[model samples]
Target: MLPIALVVAMCLGAQASLFLALTSSQDRMALAGEHELASTALREEQDSLLRLLKDYAFWDSAYQRLSLRLDTAFADENLGLYLAPAHGLDYSFVLDGQDRTIYATRGTAKTTQTALTALGAPVVRAVSAVRRIGPGGDPRVVGFTLVEGHLALFGVSAILPSPDSKMRERPGPRALMILVDYVDAGMMHELANRYRLADLRLTGARPGSSANLPVTLYGGEVAGHLTWSPYQPGTNARHQLLPWMLAVGLVVIFLAIVAVRMGRASARELIASEAKARHLAHHDTLTLLPNRRAFMERLKLREESEQAGILYLDLDGFKEVNDVFGHGAGDALLKAATERLQSIVSWRGILARIGGDEFAVLITGPLAREGAECLAQAVVQAFDEPFETAGHNLSVGTSIGVVFDNGDLSGEEMVRRADIAMYVAKSEGKHRYRAYDPSMERGRELTKQLESDLHRAIGTDQIYVLFQPVVNAGDGRTIGVEALARWRHPDRGEISPDIFIPIAEKSGLIVALGRQILREACQHTRSTGLDLAVNLSPAQFWNDNLFEDITSILEETEFPTHRLELEITENYLLRRPEAAAQVLNRLRRIGIRVALDDFGTGYASVAYLKRFKMDKLKLDRSFVERIANDSEAASVASAMIALGQALNLNIAAEGVETEDQARALRIAGCTHLQGWLFGRPQASSTLMAEIPLSRRA
Candidate 1:
């Protein structure tokens, strides 16, 4: 149909075009495949080799042997190494973090000297790069420290075999090794993706194989991969391509792309995890407020001013609520109360719940006192509205103790003072608040001082006994005296029993002091020939053998038991009614007269007056002090006296300071009186000379 020459030309053109197109397509497919396979194969080879390298990294034979020889933890216990084989580079050595060579066994092993420069020669320098190495530069060392002579933290670099060495040096031991110790969740994800395992993704992307990636699996950038003989198989990929005549790369490239992406995601996750951990450490898990540690840090800064206050708020009846409504209701109530406190004190103070049902607010500036008071009031008022819990109406109270720069106190000290104030409020009556009193502070300080002094006092025998004369009150006849202890301080002069008596009670030194005083009084009885009266406390009465101790003293001293009088409070009788009755009866049987001291002041009702066998009733000074002002007080006194007489009990009025008061009591049928008007509390030796009451009686 056409010319022969034109047909020939068309045939040649078509044949050439077909040949060129086939070549171009084959080249592109081969290129894509090889690039992918090379990347994946390189990664797979690297990973397998890395795993083998890890085996050597944890080579217990070497690291454990070294640690046992050093007889210490030398480093983090796990000596680490890293090998970067993909970039025609590898380094290996024992690293003391920072890529600083703790020891080295690269091609050039060190036998002796170890300046970091020589020890960290090849692998070490690369691992210690300050910033991550460039796409193709050698590794470098960055951060390292020998902390407290204990641990050499290795945060910066990975030390491994030489970069120049080829991989497969030991079966599958690649030249690159990394510390698995720091491999976090993200890093584990990276490792999982590197193998092209299922659910293994890179850069949040799904991958068919290592087909079209520009980089490899290692965190560092990789421009190339060297896969030698003994190539591993790479099939069963989700996506596969036909093999080119001269290429095996598509799958590898696909895998590599996935690996790079996975590494990045892992990095991002690691950062997020670190941030969350730091935040949690400073915050309270329950309230989401700054915790005690964080609060202390803030308080430490304010301590420099010494001009701060604290509000110690304690839920007064929280325990009762817990007992009645269950802990769940209590917890809900606490949460509600905390919210109330939070709302009130948020602007002017730092509030924290340092203890269970005990919250505190630290204050700065002059407003500390005012702000603390305001916050404390709000906390008290918060519970005024009854809460419904478990179908029951629940009510609670708070006792707030406020300290407004009362004195410079530590955080613990502030807490203590606030606690004391809270206790004071509770003691006075709950649902109330109190400011820190200077007297209370002084009392605590003095008590601490007394505690210290008491330890020395017994050893040095600084306490000595003094006797005060007790009289018949009627005939002014001299009776045996009361024994008292005087503290002869080395520098501060005398401390009275009133000051140290409470100290002794709180410190449990009362028993010891009582013993010393008793021994001293008996020693006096051994010398005197008259009646002796000793005051006993409720605490002392807990010892059932108190009468025995007294009898043993009297029998040993050959002193008449009838000449001794034992005085106790009605409060003590109320505590141990049956025991008190028995002990009093026993003392009377032994011919020792018993006197009820401070009788009307305690729970000494008319029923008790008749319940216990008694010989005498001693009127408390409170009633005696008001005799001149209040006729009702005198009537109370007369009622007590009449009750005593009705029970056939001798009546004694104490604190009779004036002759007029004594005359009034006598008119009211009181036969005995003891006061300064009669005689001061002078030493027994002085009283023996000043009063001639025995002859007058």
Candidate 2:
């Protein structure tokens, strides 16, 4: 018995020593992993700053303003409190060719520069070194610098010129600088919070430290030390392990003692792990909501019961936010929107973000049409206020498409119908909700077909320009003609601009279509010597070749610019005031008259009207249609005409389908009228008599 006891004791000691060693090694490895993770996070943060700096530096506006040595306005708008606080930027600056600072912001807040001497001598040398490389080639400089005894990540990028700048001449190379806080207590705390570290610290390396990490740059310059201690085992865990070690002797003495039960616990643990895996597979990571697969699964199960309601939500003006503020800001806004939606939808239904800006909610209860509409309105109203995110106040809207699912249809079909309804809501005007109806499907299919056909019709002879006479309202004489685009599909006959123009605009094909129409109109009406008005799409504002294209077409056809009128919608002008103003000014310089089409239908202010200096305003058909019946409508039309006269602008009324409407408009002081009553839009060949055959090329 003594020899057996001695053998058991030896075995027990070996087991305890082995367990402790394993625990110690695990702790060491975990500490090492934390250090590596922190290092990687810091590097990623630095990279993000560099990317943002590069984006700002390579912009045309920055290039132009910095090269001209003017950055006050740019700084006020871009490098202000919003950009820095939203992006967590500590410092940013634009420098001219002479290495002089144009503007600078610091501390996640834009502040007036008190002095440059506070940057310390080391930073000054670093900035000088970056400037010596000269701007252009997009040279990027990133490193850690000791500024005023604080370690900071600094980056510099040369400003590159934009190929499509509105500026007549390209600017010379300039540089932009950026800095982010690093190796500070606040920064360390932030990292700890993000990484869930218990003891993350930035301090000097001590003797016998468990882990010592050096923050270094590309040139291998050590900036600071990141030191951390290993996590210790819990007291309860140590006590538990001690009891198990003490039992090892008894277990070795009796073989049955070592064969304790574990199968049931293991089985339960395995089942829980599997359940967690399944849940993760069905949910979205970013929003932590059900993914498409999970939503479809839920939808399938719900369909086994009675009817269900589906609300499809699409964000409006989301693309603009992404275009202006980068994807990070977009992501922040999406998360914010998701939170708002969650507050409204908790315990009521399943909400999921199926696409970038698309979300869906499945309601599994009996809901009347009115109830569904109220819910949708509530959702719309939730986004009425601007979302404050990343230090910027951004405005966005939601268009909800609602549909009730009958037992006859599948989950995908209900979602599709809701999508169709949502698109209709967007088409009418965003920030509203629409219910699904059977008629919307047919319209959707027709729009899809038209979009498909328009692509093929652009280069073919099927698409052509038509001329509708703009007649003098006082008499029956034709004064000028408005050129309109008409598409004749191989199988579907003539498609009106009203139907296809919106599709073209949505599909981003309007630029090409507009150019084609302009070329055709110019070619057909150059010799007429009568004024030719052609509508311009808002998409043309972003087209770099717009001015060149119009000028080249005019020169090719020898079309007199003085006799050409380019009509633009008020909505487009209001959306891009500055850019549109520049385009209009350039066209005026080329002797082309500009007109505001559908003037009162959009946000028309006297200030914008004056800024554009357009030569004509066209009264929308809504006012014209109601002028004969509604006194308020008549007064508005008369007021518009009077406004046009006061501004010394010619006024034309569109959509005059009857003599009553025409007479009303004429009496209201409208100078011209164009509609079916005057003449249906006809082919340029057929309008020769109205415009005169001598004017045909």
Candidate 3:
């Protein structure tokens, strides 16, 4: 009994010692790993700094001063100011092959010079090695030996920030150089101060010693990865805190044993609880299918990664089902329909209630888009049968938007594209599926970005108007200025108008943009007293109170209404003739001019123009392009000019890109012609300052 008791005591003591030793070793290892990470960070910073230096031109006075050995103004004032910020023990020296300090910073002990000596080791070997490598050589460690008379030590890579576009001047590389020591705590602090976390110690096994100890790292280049260290923790270090480690180890062992025993039971309980809660959260009370949130989440996840299928199924004539059968009967029918859907998909796909009488099925993994469409067809076919609910037979129809995943799209973007396709399907007269087009995706990005920019356009103060002068065709005199929107993005630089205009229109932000432009044009006219012409889209007619907005802007700016002309395409009249006529009439009533643009390209119904008063007719560029080479086109232009004459409209032939084309237009009796021939769009002020060339006038 005494022997057994003694054996049990001995085993416990051995286990406790082993546990404490292991804990202490782990702590030291952790510290080493942290220090290693710092080294890597410094290395990365150095690489970035090198890139900056190579990309930009930089000149440093320090090297020149050291070479000349001159204690001059540039060295004293500029070089001193540059090096002063470094504030480290590092001293700059002119290295000569003869091993002499031609010029050394204030701290050179007489005994510091020696062959392969620690102090001279970095100065001699580092500089010589770096100079041999030159640029594009290794970045590990570089220096120019005094043998070459130049080289500087770049501190740990982490101390460097991102490079600048242009280097105004070189402040030279900063280093906490201890030519004698490997690297001390003070140098570590200096580096860490310059670059965050550069001083943090890392846990690692020490080299050639069976004990973990603190290591001060000089730079990432020299750290050489402590991870490869072969030495392990000594026994004493591992077992330093025996009893405490034993307690922790024992508690961990007990918990791990219990966890293994009840693992399956715990997992089953957790899954069941989560499933029940999720079921309740996402399902409708009576039908017990998924709700809108589930549908949206599923749709979102599907679009962001995997290729999946979304069936936006809307029950056609479900309103009549409720009206005739009553709400209780309708509820029963819904439940029956949900049951049918469940039986078809089982746990394979998500069935969700979108809204009143609207349902969606989002399926993923091994589910084909074709298969989903087939299911939709089956659903339609099944619903053809009488759904008996509340002792009554009811029939309903459905229209589904079949959206197939393209890949890597946002949930909202997918839904929107699908919705658009679905609308087209519905317009074609419902009861079918439509595949989303990849072509739409190609055009969507720029449009979306433009829409975003336009929405934040006013607040970001990113939108600015650049005015181009409109010159008179008669005498080439500046007539008016046209304002165009320009985007100066913070990161992307300049974004063109061609990219964003359509986007703004699609997002309905065009209305706001147009209003802003109108206000700007009016204000500019008031300021410069220049006549201005602005373009308007067909969508502008939607604003029933546009005339009111225009009048208010004119009043505020106190700009003459006669000086502001608005131009819209001939297609605008074809879009909504009645609305366009009313808007034109209102503008005319306000003493403002309206120009019919892109004429002879649309439904050029001469009778249509008589419906509302127009001040000018802009010949479509296509017609103008053809007139230069074709007599037939010349006749058409002649006819259009004649029509404008009889209608008392100012005829403008656009796209006169040559002197001959301008001459022909003027000969054809066109009063105004705008083209590159008459000086391409110049800044408003430049136009104001130019003297017009006399020709047609």
**Relative to the true structure, how large is the alpha-carbon lDDT of every model?**
0.56, 0.72, 0.56
Report, for all candidates in order, the number of backbone clashes.
Answer: 48, 2, 24
| Candidate 3 lDDT, 270-337, residue by residue in tens | 44544554465556656777777667776665534577777777666565656444668778878888
Tens-place lDDT per residue, model 1, 492-526, is 78888776665565454666677677676666655
Looking at candidate 1, what is the lDDT of residue 194?
40
Instruction: Name the candidate that leads on TM-score.
Output: 2
- Candidate 2, residues 1-697, lDDT tens digits: the string is 8897788777766755655554454455455556655665576566666667656765655665565456565565666555666566667766666656667777545555522354544456556666567433336677676666777777766666442222223355445554544557777777666554566776644426666578764456676676665444322234554665565556542422222222233334434544544554566556777877778888888645476788899999887777656678889999999999999887777899776688998887666345566778899999998899977888899999999865777998988888889988988778999999999877767676777789889978998888888887776677678988888888988887777888787665788898888888888877665579988786675566789989988988888889889888876665557877888899899799998888786546788788888799999888988999899999998998999898899999899899888888888899888999978888766787655444322
Return the top candidate by lDDT.
2
In candidate 3, stretches whose alpha carbon ends up further than 4 angstroms from where it belongs are 1-446, 459-461, 527-530, 691-697
lDDT for 533 in candidate 1 is 67
Model 2 lowest lDDT segment of ten: 255-264
Query: What TM-score would each prediction reach against the true structure?
Result: 0.44, 0.53, 0.38
